[model samples]
Target chain A: MASALARTTYNVFFRRSSNYLVGIFAGAFAFEIAFDSAADRLWDMANKGRQWKDIRSKYIQAADSEPADDEE
Target chain B: MFTRAAYTTATRAAFRAPTFAQARNASTQAANGAFGADRKAAAAWFAKAAAGSAILGYGISNYVVTDDRLAPVTKAVAESMTALQKKAAEYGIEMPFTVAHAFSTADHGLHPPHYPWDHFKPWKTYDHASIRRGFQVYKEVCSACHSMEYIHYRNLVGVSHTESEAKELAAEYEYEDGPNDKGEMFMRPGKLTDPMPSPYPNEEAARAANGGAYPPDLSCIARARHGEEDYIFALLLGYCDPPAGVNVREGLHYNPYFPGGAIAMARAIYDEVVEYEDGTPNNASQLAKDVSTFLSWASYPEHDERKKMGLKTLAISAMLLGLSVWWKRFKWSYIKTRKIVYKPGKFDEV
Candidate 1:
């Protein structure tokens, strides 16, 4: 019965819906890419008050405080 | 005619069990199932859209709040300007009188609001009082709009206040937040214990408040404007209506003294913007005087050290110039006397 439901007739019945959903998914992927890029640039520009060296040192110190990750 | 009854009976038997309506219903159900599945897919897609929008919103908020990349550039510019000033001096040239002018017309780069360097006519009442007034104004008014996020709480003491005083001042505001019990997150009040809080929660708030005007940080505004208290004073005072029949030049706003001067901060502070706690008048000149003094103090908070350094530099340079002049005279005389002394064995004979 499952095989029968997945037959060529299924494609004919559902092709329009599948295409519509796939297009929406594609749009979401593109939108996320553009949004991430813009967000990165804006964050870079706005949080520029701290000196690079200072921020780097801070991050390094912060990272040092965290336990090392051990993977099998 | 007797066989017709038999044919009708055969037809009834063929159509007895399954009706034609049932076949039509099965087809409609298949279509409806497909449509329902599509609607579910669409709903799942919409949920993803909502999640993506949330992430994007978070990203934008983070971007608006962060000022991560400006520090290096600011430091580089400061170092470059210092080098240029020294080089100019070495070449017997005066560096541009105003930092604003230099920034506006520097051969190196271009920025908007391009008022030429000519706006900087040197008016030397270059004193410290004006800076004190500016500080007062800052404490009273401008600080409300602008936050010196780059400046440390202790740096205020570097200006004039004592260490204890600075500490006391630092104790005023609470900072944002840190890890809470159970290692969770939450907002906390800022303290003078913390660095200055950004006035706006984010850039959007800043833009929204000032009609898209970025009221620049006053921490380095005085320094960036070439350490000129008078120019700062003049600009503060210059925000006035242009006089009638005095046509403002193209690409310039009407400032009587600012060279090709135009400004966007719509004449913010008039003569009597606020009353001084002390006996100082709230008049324009008084406001200008106080604010200028405040700005000067801000520009050179280590005012005494700067003055001492200036005096020392002046004394050394003048001494060198004088010594060079005297050395030249002495060399000329020595040469005149030694003309014959260089004649072989003349000194031995003497």
Candidate 2:
């Protein structure tokens, strides 16, 4: 269903009367990627890597524990 | 009308007895044999029996262990629980469950209220004086039982203490050095590069010293524990006598802040516990607050750095978003605002 919709959207963009629609799609796609990365960077800057369970693993209790059965 | 009646009669005759209503029911029962009335009634009876057995099992267990008249154990437990509940009332709250209570009786992950911090924010930094005083509090009080394994002497160079001060602090402890030519290990004075050493040599020794409860390391514990710094501060000061009814174990102490309303750690601080060189008041609360801040820094030396970078990133992202919007409007306006008009018969000439 989604692929069919995308095909229709691409067809509309490449058509002569709505040719500028292609530029808009390309620009929107690029902007979305850039915006996502910038948001990720902001989160990283504020959170300081403390919100992860792995960070808790650095504590003494976690260090003293035995490895899980599946883990090497 | 005659044809309809004939059809009904024909349908009824194909099933059991030729009576209309009985035959209709018989036909339905034959059609839905697997899911018929008898089968449904049997399933209902089985479900009812299962529920009855579960209720009976719970009641029997409760009678045997809790309210059992076989021994006076039930009375003692109830009396103790009632006393604990009353003691909890002194704090204007009561614990809903006890340590002896089954896990199924209570929900997990009971968090204290999230008290906000004035300094520990994404846009703010630690109060440096608090951090410094907190370190002193640790050295004087909490350091007796707790260890900060993740903190190193060098980690305090810029955040809490100067390089010379940190070095002197490091020199106070002895760390084991590697085997020399004789292949035997020896003790050496601690260096700035070394991590803070554990108080007891091993886990078993630490547990033995503290009645089978090893004191947890304080390193990064401000970040590690839920409720964060505020919870720690409250816990340090929340210790009190166990009112009338609660029975604390021989070694345990009453601390409402602990999950079970009892903790192995006794109250470690009193009024004027540690004298501050900077002449800050040496009250119990002040020490607790300062020590909590210091532990925060130990757990998160990168806090200030992260806050600074966060502010810069927020400003840059705002500018980028604004520019992107402006550029988007600039590029799309021609197509968006353009007006094309046509008269009904005038287009042919054009």
Candidate 3:
């Protein structure tokens, strides 16, 4: 049963028709190229591998500091 | 009878083959020759194979792709026209193709405040508690002028509010409905599915409320700017008195993050602006962080789900490619070292 299934897949992919080979290559390549870069866009949201509050404390004027005092 | 006859003939022929180890007559050899029949068979087989492949390719294209495949990739498919345009441009002949943006902000020499979010390193997601607090800030402050027109009460179910809480929250607003049986429009209680109502009726009203400048919608603010969520946090905290050396304009606020260091909208966030229900800090910086994270989630709600799906897709494809390679090698190995032999052919004297 396993051998028969493998043979069917093999024929569909590599031997049955040249069109199947072309479609497989196009589909695989499109998904690889498009999805890889599209997924990377989401990763841009990462901010120095820390939460927003941690990053905020670094620059935000602390409440304890006087209004006139300048933070470098 | 025919089978017996043929068997008898084959036997008689075998018996006569080596009577004296003499050469057979040319006519007899020609009668048994296979070269013409083999050539005819090869041509017929290829004709059928070609027709089959053509039909299969046509059928496959119906599902895989219908339009021209090159349309997506070709920047300019008319290679001749692009070559001509380049040549003409090089010769100082300008065309009307390139248009510049109106009111491009000039550099003010004020450097941008430093913040993280420059790289694709590590990972990020909105803090749910922070997002809830941010929603409070928006409801109490920003909602007076700016609006998040795209978001719906239903969207808050898992991210910020419980399902029943979201339904109750949505019920507070009165949304306008279609014409009734009397041909008059009527007001209806807002549903969980209803979009957040704009603070102002129109753009003109929104602009009038905030001087001449219209407060842009915050629905996609995180994505609209290149800086993403960090820029919004910085902008809220950026407001300050103008530098003494520069002339301060009337009715404009000072923020170095603003392109010209002048902004129409007054500073909105302040320390202890909103009383947090969760007993979290209510400082300006804390509020800014929470609000920015909320806006980020609003811009990209399904980011976590998307990333999970992308990881799964990539892993599955990688496994498929590996399996396909192994299968190809396994099947082709049988034919790799195969050889064939044939008997030497007789040639008639030229």
A-chain TM-score, model 3: 0.40
- Reference contacts reproduced by model 1: 0.00
List the global CA lDDT of all models.
Answer: 0.54, 0.71, 0.69
What interface-residue Cα RMSD does candidate 2 give after superposition? 13.6
Per prediction, fnat is 0.00, 0.00, 0.12
In CAPRI terms, model 1 is classed as: incorrect
Displacement of the residue A21 alpha carbon in candidate 3, Å: 21
For residues B1-350, write the lDDT of model 1, one tens digit per residue.
Answer: 53878878987775454334443444344433433545677577779989999999898767854556666778898888888888888989888742554344323211223232221212122232333345567666667777766666555442333344455566666665657877867765444356656678776788788766576776666677643555666676665566665565443445543544444355556666776644557777677656655554455555544443454456557968988855554444423322243455545555
Candidate 1 deviant stretches above 4 angstroms: A1-72, B1-130, B180-195, B225-228, B242-267, B270-273, B302-304, B317-336, B339-350
Better of 2 and 3 by DockQ: 3
Which candidate number has the best lDDT? 2
Which is the leading candidate under DockQ? Answer: 3
Task: Give a tens-digit lDDT track for model 2, residues B1-350.
Answer: 45888877876655433334444444444433434356777688779989999999998778755544645876788889889888988888858774575552113323455556656555556776677778889988888889888788877765555555677889999898989899999999999899877778777888999999888899979888877887788888888887688788999988766777778888987879899977889889888888988888788777766775677667768988988865554544433434488767745655
> Tens digits of per-residue lDDT for model 2 on A1-36?
147886686676655556766678887899768866
Interface RMSD for each of the candidates: 19.7, 13.6, 13.8
Q: What's the ranking of the predictions by DockQ, best on top?
A: 3, 2, 1
Error of 2 at B350 (Å): 19
Top-TM-score candidate index? 2
Q: How well is each residue in B102-221 modelled by candidate 3, as lDDT tens digits?
A: 663323424445565322222455555677788888888888888888999888865576555667788889999879999999999989889887999999998887778888899999
